[model samples]
Structure formats: C-alpha cells, structure tokens
Target: MAKDDTGRLHVTVKTGGKRKLSSKLWLERQLNDPYVAKAKREGYRSRAAYKLKEMDDKYKLLKPGMAVIDLGAAPGGWSQIAARKVGSAEGKGKVVAIDLLEMPEIPGVAFAQLDFLAEDALHRLREMLGGGADMVMSDMAPNTTGHRTTDQLRILGLVEDAAAFACEVLKPGGSFLAKVFQSGADAALLAQLKRDFTTVRHVKPAASRQDSSERYLLATGFRRASAVL
Candidate 1:
C-alpha cells in the first residue's frame, strides 16, 4: 500500500467482493479500475506505471537506448517501465533512480536511497549518470500539511530543483517529465523551462484521478546555454 498526498493509505481491491460498505465500495472500484487490472496482468508493481507510459507515448520521449534519471523512484514502478523502454544497460540504455526511502532492487536498473535535498546529492546523481541524461523523471512530492498552499510550495520546490538539475545535466535533445499538482507550477517556473527547452506543456493523463489536483509538466528539446569561460 502507498500513501496519497494527504497521508492516506490507498489500496486497490475489489469493493464488490465483501459485504461491508467500505469494502464493497473499494472492491468495486478496484475491479473496475482499468489501470489496476492492467498492472496486475502486466506484472507491474503499481498502477502508476501507466501514467508514465501514457505520457511517454504521447510525447515519444522514451526510447531503446537512452540514459534516464528517476527522482523519488520507489517500489520500482516507473523504474521498471523505464528499464523496459530504454533497453538493457549493455544495449545503451541505463536508468539510475534515487529517493530518501529504500526501494527493492530492480534488475537492469540502479537505485540510490538518499535524500535529493542532502548535500551533494545532485553531484552524486551526475556521477551515477557518468554522462548527461536523455530524460529526467520525477515523481517527488513533499510531505503534505492540511494547508493547500503549504503543500503546493513544497512540491513546487521539488519540481524547481528537478528542473534546475535537469538543465545542468540533460543533453541538448533531452526531455524532462515531472509530476505537479494542478495549478501548482508558477509562471516563474514555466518561464525558466521555456528559456531552456524548445517545447513545454502541462499534461494530465486519464489514468490520474479526476478529483486529484495532480498534473505533469512535460518539457522537451533541451537547449544548450552558452557558457562564459
């Protein structure tokens, strides 16, 4: 089970299978949740994998031999999808994932359980990549308070950091994908991305719950900024 933005444990099961009201409700939802059934049939860790897949499909960002970095990657859901799409390490694709929480090892992918906010974390990620990355993905969300503004700011900080790091390390044609709450990313952030990328858009996949404020920022075509020596 995973916690939602409000620290509520979310479980996927057939709500119609039990007599209790809550159980029946939950089970019915699970039974009807296309993503849940798809995940189970496809052997994925969580239904969230489909979100990335949908995004990538629309943007055509993932490929068979690209280097990728996954921030806040846990339970290996997105990592698994990345690994499969990027091909094996020997074949030119590699994925390096990091989070403050420990995650089980996934074959053909590398992981580091460390806080991204910690000192030298970005440097460590660069070292892991060995070279620049073709894609940087983040599903990071800060610990939420009951206050909406507070939560939005915290999450915005994460996306800002991710975007900065990506600009520093992404290749000229690379892409960045990040999760953000709807209406959370400010104009400043969008302007910054527009300066560095050829294309920038916000996307909300159908798999995401309609009631949730979550959305994603999809940026493509990294532009090499001129440097002064």
Candidate 2:
C-alpha cells in the first residue's frame, strides 16, 4: 500500500500464478476503497451500507417505528441500517429480509433464506411482517454474463418483480427503492410506478461507485392497494 498524490492510500495487487488479472484488479479495488475501510471500522456488514445511509439521509425514507422489508438482502448491509433507523433493535419497529443466500443474524432483522421470486416468498414475508410495510427496498442485481443488454434485461426483470411485491406489501404512503442499470429500458416499470406512487425519481447516491452504471428508482407515497385494484 502506498499513498497517491491525492493522499489516498492505494493498494497494488501483484498479478501472477493463480490470480487472474480481473481477480487481482477487484482485490486491489476493494483494498483501496475508502468505503470498504469505513464499513469495517463502523461494523457495517458491507460498503453498501453507505449507499442506503446516504439515500435515507437525503430522502428521509427510513423512520423510527417504520416497518421495512429488504429484498435480496444478502450480506445484511441494508438490513442493518434499516434495523437501526427504524428502531427495530429497540423493539420499536420491524425489519424482515429475504435472500437466497444465508446471512448471519443481525440484531433486529428477521432473515429468510429464500429466493424472492419464489411463489411463496411474498406470503412468507407478509407472515413475518404481520402487516404492510412502510418501505420496501431492493439492491438485488442479477449475475452478469458480461453482455450489457442481457444483464440490463435481467436487472429490469428483478426490479419489476420487486416492484410488484412492494405494491402488494406496502401500505398507502409507503416507499419503494430498487437498483437499475443506466439503460432506458425501464419505461414500462417507471410508468407503473408513476401510476401507483405520488412521486418517482432516479437516485444515485455518492456511495455508489462513480463508474458503476447502477442507479436507484425511488418511489414514494404509494396509492392504497384498494385504490390500485
């Protein structure tokens, strides 16, 4: 590790033997990323915690006593922030998270290891929350095949499914946030969100890597399910 002219610590990963160039680059990036360091220092599960924290700071999405649902919540970074902001740790709110991968326990989060797209997933999440949630958020991304169009389509599909579940599980005036790629393929999803929500906008928090194509669709003030139906 050495300091760059900007005084930022830089980590160099020697490339050789079993380490592929891509793997070496990824490791070097992780080692030098300030947010990764900060996350470790702050006891957050991942650097992604800063993304939610920054978004919530700007939007005031998570509140004390709110019921939150975190979809694709593996690694439990976003769940951790939600649990703290919603006072779940103090028994003042509720947080339920679902992912296909197993995550270690977070103090205030109820974790379910199941695919969010499964037929029974929504039912199971509803059972866990015992009622509608004040907010539904998803940072889920599909596995990339290095094909941009294919990856974008997969991401959009995930976002659509997450939006559909959010509509069913969110209370009136609730909020939804999901990750999306930079492609303009989300017109249909945005149209549906605009119809179901009072406000819909794109958010790219500073914590999101500047080079990443990832952006968030933030929808708030949900219409009641009855009204939508």
Candidate 3:
C-alpha cells in the first residue's frame, strides 16, 4: 500500500483472481475513499449522504416540518438525511422517497418504487403531499451507454424531466436540488430553471471526489405562477 496525495494509505488491488481491471480499480477506490469510511461510522447508507449533508449545512435547507420529495432515492441515503433534518421520524414532517429500485425502510421515509418519469408518478406524489411541496431533491442518473454523446443526452434528458417535475409540485418559494455531471445541465434546461425559479446555480460539495466531474444543480425560490404547472 502507498499513501495517496492526502497521505491516506491507498489499498492496491491485485490484477488477477478473475477480477476485471475496471472492477478491481473501482473496489480499490471504494476501499480508500474517506467518505465511504465515514458513512459506515456515522450509520449512513452511502457516501452520497455526506454530499447532501454538506450542502444542507451550508444552505440551511431542509427545515423542520417541511414536506420534502426525494427522487431517484434508491439506497435511501438522501432520504435518511431529509427525514432526520425535517423531523419526519418524530412525525413533525413528511418525506417521500421515490426510486426505481426498492431499499429497506428508513425511519421516516415513505418509499415509493415508481418511476418519477412515469405519468402517474407526479400525480401520486402530489396526492401524497396534499398538492404542495417545500423541497425536491434528486440523485437520479440514467443507465449509461459506452458512447459518451449518447450518455450525455440521456443524462440531460433526465435532468430536464426532473426539473419539470420540480416546477409542478413545488410550492411558491420552494427549492429543488439534483445531482448533475460533466458540463452540468444543458443550456435550455438552465434557462428554463432561471425562468421558473428565483435563483439557479451549481454546487460541488466537498464530500464529492475532486477527480469526479459530478456536481449538484440547485434552483430555489420557485415562482409557481411563472412555472408551466
């Protein structure tokens, strides 16, 4: 093992043992990732929990008793933070976690195994939240093809759809946050967000790896009357 630039010992993986180079590299990175270790100690499900935690810490998002929606919430990492911060576990707030995949229960998150892109999904969430939401957060990503251009299109398409959903359910003055990558959202989406919300910006939490191009697109102060919804 050798130390990384951070002076943490880098655990090297062997090339053999039927492990593909890609898989071996991924395992080694996970083993050495500080966020991964911290998540375990803090009883969080994934390293992503810290990303939301850091942003919320700085932005003062997720106030108690707010009705929150979590899209692409599988593994339920973001849901856990939302529930705790909003006091959902104590029954003072509401958190709905929606995902294509199912995970074990979190203390206060109401999990929905449904596609947020589906026609009925928005209606279902609206009904659950009594037609208004204080915040919406997404950690969704599309299944990537090996082709870079195709993958980028898929990612942007997903972000656009998520933004549309946020515009619909969010109350006036509500907020939206989503995970984005590469060059971030497309121009049209960015324009749409700026029009529909009072402020739109990109944020990269310290918990996110510096080597990764990933970041978060955050839009706050929804203008419900100006939104297409």
Candidate 4:
C-alpha cells in the first residue's frame, strides 16, 4: 500500500499474464476506494450502499411503513439499505426487488430473478409489492459496448423503462430514483418526469466515483396516474 496525494493509502494491483490492464486498474481502484473499505467494515454487501444512504439522507425518500420496489437489485446492496430504512425487518414496510440475476436472500427483502423489461415483470412486481409502492428506485446499468454513444443510449433506455415502471406502480405522492448517464437522451425522460411529478432533479451522490459519469434522476411527489392521462 502506498499513500496518495490525498493521504489515503492506495493499493496497486500488479498486472501479469492473464490479468488485463483494465482488470488490474479496476482492482486497484476498488482496493483504494474508501467506500469499499467502509462497506466491508460495516458489513454491507457493496460500496453502492453509500450511494443510496447518502441520497436518502438528503431526500428523505424512505420512511417507515412505505412500500418500495427495487429494479435491477443485484448483489442486494441497495435493497439492504432500503430494508433497514423502511423497517422491513420489523414488518413496518415492504421491499420487493427484481433482477435478471439471482441474489442471495436479504433478511427483509423479497427477491425475484426476473428481468424488469420482461412483459410480465410489472404484473409480477405489483403482486409482490401487494399494492402501489411508496417509492421505486433502480440502480440498473447496461453492459458497456465500449462505444460511448451506444453505451449512453443503452443507459437511457434502461432508465426510461425503469421510470415508466415507476409510473405504473407508484402511489400518488410517491418518489422515483434511477441511475442515468450524463447524456443527451436524459432530456426526454426529464420532460416526461416533469409532467408526472411535482419536482424532478438530478443528483450525484458523493459515493459515486469522481471519474464516472453516472448520476441519479430523483423525481418526487408523483402526480396521480389520472393526472398524467
């Protein structure tokens, strides 16, 4: 471990035969990230937990007894935070999560191994939620294609679908938060959000990597579904 200019100890990963430069760099970044270390120390699943924690601190999105739906909740980091904040463990609230990959059980979360984009997904999620959700949050990210424009479009499409699902399941005055990239496609989604929500804004939590273009679109006070029609 070597100390960087910021006085934080940075771990360097040595690249060799099978280890690609990109893999080495990513490993080094994870080793040196303070949030990664903190997450391990706190027993959280991943460093991504801090992103939701920070956002909830600022926005007060989670409340006891509120129902929450998590999209693309893999590895269960965000679901863990939501479960605790909403008191799902004590049955004060409910947290239902869906992802294409299977996730290990989180004490207070109900996980479904299904793609959120599937035709039957919304209906299944609504059944799991049991009723309209108080909040819908997503941390879904597309597999990078190495092409900047293509990657951005994919991210936009994922967020748009998440937003549309949020509209379908969220109760009046509910909230929606989803991960998005810094790209032109966000404008269209923002316009739709403005029409359906009382307030819509973008947030970049401190836990997100400084070099990353990722940000979250937070829309709150959702108008009744009839209002949009």
Error of 4 at 157 (Å): 0.6
Count the clashes in each prediction. Answer: 6, 0, 0, 0
Question: What is the per-residue lDDT of model 4 for residues 1-229, given as tens digits with 9 covering 90 to 100?
Answer: 7889999777889878899999999898888889999999998999999999999999899999989999899888999999999999999999998988899999989999998878998788788878788899999999999899999999898888898888888888999999988887678789999999999999999999989999999999999555221
The candidate that wins on lDDT is: 2
Where in model 4 is the C-alpha error above 4 Å?
227-229
Better of 2 and 4 by lDDT: 2
TM-scores for all candidates? 0.82, 0.97, 0.94, 0.96
| Candidate 1, residue 97: lDDT | 93
Candidate 2 Cα lDDT to native: 0.92
Please write out the lDDT profile of model 2 over residues 1-229, one tens digit for every residue. Answer: 7898899878899999999999999999899889999999999999999999999999999999999999989899999999999999999999999898999999999999998778988788888988788999999999999999999999999999999889988888999999999998999999999999999999999999999999999999999555322
- Candidates, ranked, lDDT: 2, 4, 3, 1
Off by over 4 Å in 3: 226-229
Ranking by TM-score: 2, 4, 3, 1
Cα RMSD, each candidate: 6.6, 1.5, 1.8, 1.7
Q: Give the deviation of candidate 1 from the true structure as CA RMSD.
A: 6.6
